[model samples]
Target: MKFASTGLTALLLASVAVPASAETLRWARAGDALTLDPHAQNEGPTHTLNHQIYEPLVLRDEEGTLVPALATDWHVSEDNPNVWVFELREGVTFHDGAEFTADDVVFSLNRAMTEDSDMKELLSSVKEVRAADTYRVEIETEGPNPIMPANLTNMFIMDQEWAEANDAVEVQDYEGGEDTYAASNANGTGAYRLVSREADVRTVLEQNEEYWGADQFPMDVTRIEYTPIQNPATRVAALLSGEVDFIQDVPVQDLGRVSQAQGLEVETAPQNRTIFFGLNVGADDLQTDNIEGENPLANRQVREAMNLAINRDAIRQVVMRDQSIPAGVIAPPFVNGWTEELDQISTDVDRAKALMEEAGYGDGFSIQLDCPNDRYVNDEAICQAAVGMLAQIGITVNLDTKPKAQHFPLITGFTGDETDFYLVGWGVPTFDSAYIFDYLVHSRDEEYGSWNATGYSNPELDAKIEGLASETDLEARNQAIAEIWEVVQDETMYLPLHHQVLNWGMTDNIDVPVDPEDQPKFKRFALN
Candidate 1:
């Protein structure tokens, strides 16, 4: 399971070959997958890497259409409204030659609900999972969940036998810094097989010769070499120099340069992610701030002042190079509950200063801002810009920037001492506002709030958010969604920034669509 030190170098050298048929794809991104454990992290790049080796029951196509993957068909049980029945696809085999069956589905779903699993919140409604037969399985939820299928699009299924044999039944404690067998090794019924993996360095995957969908899909790619290039200039240089064939993130500053280069093309798409700032409003006292005896973020006037002080337009134009869409709400435009009225906030530094003074902090205060340098596009630069803008209103900011691997734990409910202020980006995979309310806005608890490092909690809003899961009436569910947003907007629980835009740079011979979720399935790719 461990990668040989010299094997990665040999693989990297072999990856430069350009077959006449485009059989190999050298892919690079800003950050590497945290772990190969399917249930370990809910991160975008991690999911993108795992998708090549593990698959969920259902998946989203290039156009965001839901399609069956491991499961052939699924529906609610006629007799029991709270139970859903899924028909597993037959003739599918794991890379280890084990047959895919209902037991794997049952086990994988239960594993995803374990306490250590980052995917637990997505399956909070599930009461139990039962395998009816070799290829049939049933899931009983706590209540009737109309959109249960939507939740399974990213819940990857792991082979029960493979996990038990390898003693990897427990999900890796990524946040706790505990590495397990699953962290470095993988076994799944995906399109590609893991040939070698050297964390943060290189990972090699070859086509699964016995893949069940070999005949169904074009299977254009025979080999995949993935690299994690953290530096923007280095990433673009690799692509421009033909050291890499494709890169998921094409820096805005180099988009024109890359596009103009011969044999290179840039594909752009509106991402479904929103980047924003989180404040510890629920804390009684701040840990990283100089304010004494009280938390400044707890003051509504102060929070509103911070929100008004931010100029999203400037960040969009200067930092994002006019590639991002300025946003007024945390939820993106694609989500159901988004409205123009809710997304119409304007910047006013004068009003912001007035609010700060009205809150009895005319002299201002100092706090630290934690940000990730490699996670989002210009993530660190964006935080640096915020520091300057907040300084205008007398709020001195000490910015701490690090790689996402080290920076994410500050906000992912890992450390006891969470960051008082931080920058994070979120994407709505389920295409619902309830996803936002459940994780970001809800009160911190064992089941939910794993990502709500802000410490903001309200019992009334928590009940409404939990209700969205079982509310079968579409209108009623949407009403609850709107009510939750109203409170979120009024409280300024998160300082909304802007929606990110995706730019993928690849060789002219490669043809792949930009996925809104930022996950590109290599199996569906075609090379001209």
Candidate 2:
């Protein structure tokens, strides 16, 4: 009888403690992850997961300012603007019990500069990443770069010894999956640890009890399950049905339904991302056969014509369901030092037609347009809408929509000396206009390296981008950006659509902070 009474008491304690202390937040979304290797891909669902798995040297605050993360404090060299010194927080240890040190930072950064790595170009400006001491490191840049912290925000630090032990040294080839050592396995000095991964189905993460940080409210959230439910309707249904706690990429159409749900609430925040279309400016030949020229997009007039034909307002209303704000330039509002002068693009169809006629295409021609089906919110639908709009100007668009997995390689692969006209969205990690100039405006041969997929090249723009990168004076950098924006608009190398809103539906039990930059962090969330 005494043993039975003791067992009953133990069961009562388990009932109260299990639900209170060991809560598992089941989050759902409508996209599959490309890879878990943080350096392999720069965008999409992986970004959200990576946020939970890894902590970079720096993180952007709510106001888009760079704040320390892994590093406790840092200082820019007074003598040389290119040199940045950082003081590492001592006593921080990786999940595998490996100590965090300067060597890990150097290994992760140097590996990021490998040729085969997709994110190699992000760290291309760094001349050297050397350890000044065990608790400090200094990054010497190839030139005077102001946006160093912003650029390196996504360069998550890895365990050098752990990586070497697992034979994960060549970070370029690490694709986290069934056949890889890094797949469903991780060893980071972050707040969580990867417990299990079921591809396209679910990923489970457990709180790192050994995390050397301030106490987390859900100190032991044993199993946070992340599931990718592709259909928007199904995802929303699951949320309303109490199957999931949170659902991302909430369809704009169902915002009303979600908002009206009994225990659910809807949240909308401006994401520092720009959705745009790239014309094949650098390609030797146009993908379409109707244009009989050497390179149709190469003609400044032709590029402008394509831009004006698409009614961005209609796309914002219909395709995006009014969830997007029309964009004038590549850089969005939240990006630091972004000016109003940069938002200068004419939406005149008649002028565009005149330009097209001058370029010898009075009647528009047929072309194949490439789009990613799973990359953005309603990405494929947006492309379909664009096809109809382009058709109005006699431009017959053969839309070739593919999943991001298949789409990224074919178009972004510059090896074939080709890239078809395609649609893409860039969420600027650095939250700076310099990111725009460096990635899109600067030439592939330059110090920062290549993100110029369209092959849009101009000597004037290159000089302006270079000037902005190195310019210490705030006004001087802004002036350089203004000049670069003017040249880009004049050339019409890209068609800017709108900065789409990120809609999320969640229970009011948690406080999820919103930053226009969309860092995907819930640094202060807790269950009521």
Candidate 3:
């Protein structure tokens, strides 16, 4: 679907309404957005919050279909196959009343490619971004990129004028623990505007009256009251007591209670996210383990043993409350490179013990398992369960749990490794396997491997992973993808857990679909 092309004056006049009829939506979740700066953190919750206030060149609808946003139309330039052209939407204005133009598009794309931007990995193929005209921009890549548009769905545009005036042109150094004005303030050309922000506490937003698509969408929600409720009981109670109108993270343990409550309903869908365990296999000596001067994870047999020790079925039934699909591969089914052969693994404690004994560790060792309590559904609980399962194989685990804000840094920061074993979740925004290899399996470097805490790197695999970006032939590209997955599976780089199932609890009065990405845009919402 495309945006309405009728003149903006008609759109504004048709959307104007009395304030007395305005509807307010109270939303609660387990964790808050990491920052208001669009390029600061490439996290799910942060992108969800920014989707309301920031306008990207392209966006995904509730069904994960790509749609035009800031750009009305886009296509590869006929004269230059390596260049992509984007035509901007007319009569659009930023939240601060700044005019939207190609300059802002060029600036925002360039800003997102900077060293401090966590979004740099998505634009690694772009060679340059230049404005062709007042409302047209061209992005030149090093090679022909057939799926370039897929990469821009989350590349939000920022107002160059507002950024420079506020000294916020530089993206916030989130991993380095630096804060800037843009971290707390926002200015964009989306359907909503930020009214106030109190980090980790509350953020309020009001509908954009002069929004370009005011009449193009339902725009039923006039105000949004977003709160981060970490406690599962409090989040459910807020919904039951009418303190909040909606919640995205409905705890699996309380799904029955919420659905049985009066005036409430639970909507569910399969999420495109995978939860898994990462081991620091690259280290010569485990930093967080009792086995000194030797890394047990460094042995392939040991890693395979750990994978066998995990009872994915048990975790799915007990820890996830049957709300997750036990997975054998790191990539979800929605991604291009996933296959049944790659998604098949079995649990065998006896085999795991034998592998440990074969690897010269007859007496099992102990290690620390770092996990986030609020990031994934039953994240901490999953680690705790793994601790017990590993104990059956004589391997003791020390579980350390904390909020996501504190746990994410141990993996993403540029500093030295801080985790020996960790529980983490990954979602493929680009819906491709290259996204997985580049960040997780590739060697840690400046451009890629920002999330690879495993310390595992293979030069041959790295070359194959990088080749996917420029490989245009679909047949050959898929072949290479399959080959890479074969190696990744054999190496047992990560212990795959399961694909999460989404459960959204809301009042019956609101009509909205559960997004597989777990991001629900209020502009598409309606009061039934």
Q: How many residue pairs clash in each candidate at the backbone level?
A: 0, 0, 0
lDDT of each: 0.89, 0.73, 0.87
Worst 10 residues of 2 by lDDT: 1-10
The pairs that clash in candidate 2 are none
lDDT of 1 by residue, 1-528 (tens): 012233543454446644333798889988889999999898889999999999999988867778999999999999999999999999999999999999999999999999888888888889999999999999999899888888888899999999999999999989899999999999999999999998988899999999989888778999998888877887787787778889989999999999999999999999989999999888888887888888999999999999999999999899999999998999888788999999887899999999999999889999999999888999999999999999999999999998888888888863435799999999988889878887788887878888998888899889889889899999998888888899999998699999999999999987777898889998888888
Global fold similarity of model 2 (TM-score): 0.90
Per-residue alpha-carbon lDDT of candidate 2 for residues 385-445, written as tens digits (9 for 90 to 100): 9898777666788998876766676544554244557888877877677776776667766
Clashing pairs in 1: none
* Evaluation by lDDT, superior candidate among 2 and 3: 3
The candidate 1 region of ten consecutive residues with least summed lDDT is: 1-10
Tens digit of lDDT per residue, candidate 3, span 401-421? Answer: 988888888888734458888
Instruction: Identify the candidate with maximal lDDT.
Output: 1
Better of 1 and 2 by TM-score: 1
User: TM-scores, in order shown?
Assistant: 0.96, 0.90, 0.95
